[model samples]
Target: MEPESGVNGTAIAEFILLGLVESPGLQPVVFVVFFVAYLVTVGGNLSILAAILVEPKLHTPMYFFLGNLSVLDVGCISVTIPSMLGRLVSHKRTVPYGACLTQLFFFHQLAGVDCFLLTAMAYDRFLAICRPLTYSACMNHTVQRMLVAVSWVCAFTNALTHTVAISTLNFCGPNVINHFYCDLPQLFQLSCSNIQLNELLLFGLGVLMAGAPVILIVTSYTHVAIAVLRIRSAEGRKKAFSTCGSHLTVVGIFYGTDVFSYMRLGSVEASDKDKGIGILNTVISPMLNPLIYSLRNPDVQCALRRVLTRKQAMV
Candidate 1:
C-alpha cells in the first residue's frame, strides 16, 4: 500500500497483531492461562458486586466506589482478553482498523477512569481514617456521585484526545502491531504519518491522567500514614495500618508498573522481558486488584459472608 491524500488512502483496513511471539508451541498454554484469568476476573468482580448489593452495611461511599472499580476492572480486562483468546485459537491475530481504534478508545477510557477512581478511593480512605470527625459530611452521597461522574468524564476526555490524535495519522504500510493488544505507542509506530504531536499529546495526557493521580494518591497516603502514626494505642495504630495496607500495596504496584511503562517516552525498546512486564500491567493487574482489596478488607469479607449466608438461606 502507498500513502495517498485525504479520504481514500493506501492504508490497509486491518492490522496484523504480532501477539506475544510467533511460537505455535506456546499458543495453547497462553490461551488457557488468559482464558482462566478472564473467567476468574469476571467472577471475582461480580462477587464483589453481589456482596456490595446484598449487604446493607456495604452500601457506603467506599463500597459504592469499590463496586464501580470492580465493574471498570471487568471492562478493562474484557476489552483486551476475549480478542486475544480468539486470536490464539484461530492462529489469526489480525485486528480490523476500526476494531483497533475502538479497542484503544475503550481500553484507555476505562483504565484512565480507574486511575482517578483509585485516587478518589485513597482520598476516601483519608477522610475515613485521617479525618473521621467529619467523614460523613466530607464524603457525602452527593460528593461520591460527583466523584464517580468526574472520573468517567476525565477518562472519556483523556481517551478522546488520544483517539482523535491517533486517528488523524495515516498508516499506509506494515500494518502489523507488535503487541497483543492495541497500545497507542505500538500503533503509533505503525503509522506512516508523523506522530510527533501524538507522542507529545500522549506523554502530556499520561502525566495529567495517570501521573497526576499517582501524585494525589501518594499525597493522600502520606496523610493517612501520619494519621495512623498519631493514634495513641498500639492496637489502634496496627488496625489503622492494616486497614490502609491493601490500598497502599495496590497503589504501589499499579503506579510502579505504570510509571515504568510510560515514564521513558522516546525510543522505547520492547524486548521479550519488557513485553512480559507490560502484559502484567495490562492483563494481570486488573485481575489482582479486586482480589487484593476484597480479600484484605475485613469489612468486605464480612459483607461477602452476609451476602453468601443470605443467599444460602434463600436457597
Candidate 2:
C-alpha cells in the first residue's frame, strides 16, 4: 500500500508481526512446540467440555462453569495461535487493520468472560463448602445462565469500547507490532495519536475486568480457608481444599502473566519479555487449566473414563 497525498511516509494499511522467534533457525522448533501446545489445549478443554455434557452425574454448578471456561480457552487460543503459527513459518506476516480490530475485540471479550467465570467458579466453591445447605437453591441453572449472560454483556461492551477506540488512532508509520498477536498495549506503542485517554480507559477497565475479580477470589478463598480449618475431620478438609486447588493454580498463572503484561510499560527490551509472557498466557496456561482441574477431580476422571470407554466400546 502506497502513501496517500500529504500523508507522512505511507499511510499504514497493515502491521507486521514480529513473532516470538526472530532467528530463522529457531522458527521451526518454536513453531512445533507451540503447535503441539495448541493441540493439547484444544484437546484437553474439549475433553472436559464433552465429559460435562455427556455425563448426567457430573452436571453441577462447578462443571457448568468449567465447561464455559474450557470453551473460552479454546476461543482464546484459536484467535491468536493461528496467526502466531503462520508468522513463525511465513515471511509475509502483515495483518490488516480490520483483522487486528477483530482479533483485539474477541481476545479481550473472552478475557473478560474468563475473569468473570473464574470469579463465579470461585464463588461456586465458596458456596459448596461454606453454604452447603443452600448451594443448590442459590445457584440453580437459571442463576448460572444469568451470571454468564451478564458476563458476556459486560465483556462485549468492554471489548467494543477498546476496539472502537483503537480504530480512531492514527498510525503514520513504523507499523511493525512487537508481539505475535495484535494486543492493545502493542498497538498503543505504534500510535502517533495521544493515548492518555486510551491508557485511562485500559486502567479503568483493568480494575473491572481483572482487579475486582482478584479481590473477590481472595475474599472468597479467605472464608474458605477459615471454614476448612474449622472442619473436624482431616479427610473432609482435604476434599474441600482439593476442589479449589486447581482453580487457584490456574488463577495464579493467568493473573500473574496478565498483571505483568498490562502493568508494565512497553519498550525495546520489554517486547521480548512480553512475548514470553504472551506464550504463557496463550499457550501454556490454557493447556494447564483443564489438566489441573481433571487431575485433581475424581468425578471428572470417572466421567472421562466413562466417555472414553463408551467411545471404545462403540468403535
Candidate 3:
C-alpha cells in the first residue's frame, strides 16, 4: 500500500510493524504470557532498586552500580515490552512514525546505557578484587558518581546520533518494518532515501558502543580470574571467585548475544534465529542480571533476608 503524503510531503506518517509472529491464533496466548513477564520484570527490578536505596549496608559502590543497572533494565525492557504486549493482545500492530522514532530513541538509549554500566561494574569488581589495597581510594563516592554520569552521557550521545540519522532518512516505500520494533537495520533497509550515511553511522557506532567495552570487560576479568588463582588459601580463592563469577556470567551472556546480533556490517539477512537471540539479550538478559548478581552473592542475599525479615515483622 502506498503511503499518503504528510504535511511536509513525507510519504510515511505511520508504519505497520510485522511484529515477531503473525499467527492470529497465537497472539492472545503470547499476550498473556508476555504481559506477566513484563509485570515481573518491572516489579522485580523495582524491588531490587528499592532495597538498594533503603539498605544502608548496600550503600557501597557495587550495589550503587547494580541500582543503576536495575534502572537501566527497567527502561530498556519498557521500551519494547509494553508495545509488544499491546501488539500481542490487540487486533492491530500499527505504529505511527512518531511513535516508532520514540521507541528507537529510548530503546537504543537504555540499551547503550546497560552496555556501559556493565563495563563500569566490571571495573568496580576489578578494583575491589585486584587492587583491594587501593579499592577504597580508587572507587570512592566521587569516582563512582563520575563513572555513572559518564555512562549515561555516552549512552545518550550514542543514541541521539542514531535517532537523528534515522529521522533524516526518507521512508518513501514499503512502510512496513518486518520486526516487533523499530530496529536500525530493518528501518534502513525499508527506506527509499539514500541510507548510505545511516548505514555508515550505524556500523561505526555499533562497533564503538558494543565492541570497546567488551574488550575492556574481557581484559578486566582475565586479570580478575588470574588474581583469583593467586590466592594461596582455597577459602580465599573461593571468596574471590564467588564475587566475580556471577558478574562475569551476566557480562558474558549479555555481550556475547549482543555482539553476535549487531556486529554485522553488510546487508546480512538477520534470521528469526538472529532476532530470537537479540530478544534474549534485550529482554531475557536484563531480567537475569538482578537475579544472577544478587542471588549468587551472599552479601546481597543477607541484605534481602534482613529487609524481608523486617517487613515481615512489621506486617
Cα lDDT listed for each candidate? 0.82, 0.87, 0.81
RMSD of 1: 2.6
Worst 10 residues of 3 by lDDT: 1-10
Off by over 4 Å in 2: 1-10, 266-270
Question: lDDT tens digits, residues 111-230, model 1?
Answer: 888889889999999999888999999999999999999999999999988877777788776887777888776776677777788878888888899878888888998999898888
Best by lDDT: 2
Measured over all alpha carbons after superposition, the RMSD of each candidate to the real structure, in angstroms, is 2.6, 2.4, 2.8
lDDT of 2: 0.87
Task: State which candidate has the highest TM-score.
Answer: 2
In candidate 2, the residue pairs with backbone N, CA or C atoms under 3 Å apart (3 or more residues apart, or in different chains) clash, namely none
- Deviation from native of the Cα of residue 72 in model 2, angstroms: 0.4
Residue 70 error for model 2, in Å? Answer: 0.4
Q: Candidate 3, residue 129: CA error in Å?
A: 1.5
Give the C-alpha lDDT of model 1: 0.82
Per-prediction tally of clashes? 0, 0, 0
For model 3 the TM-score comes to 0.92
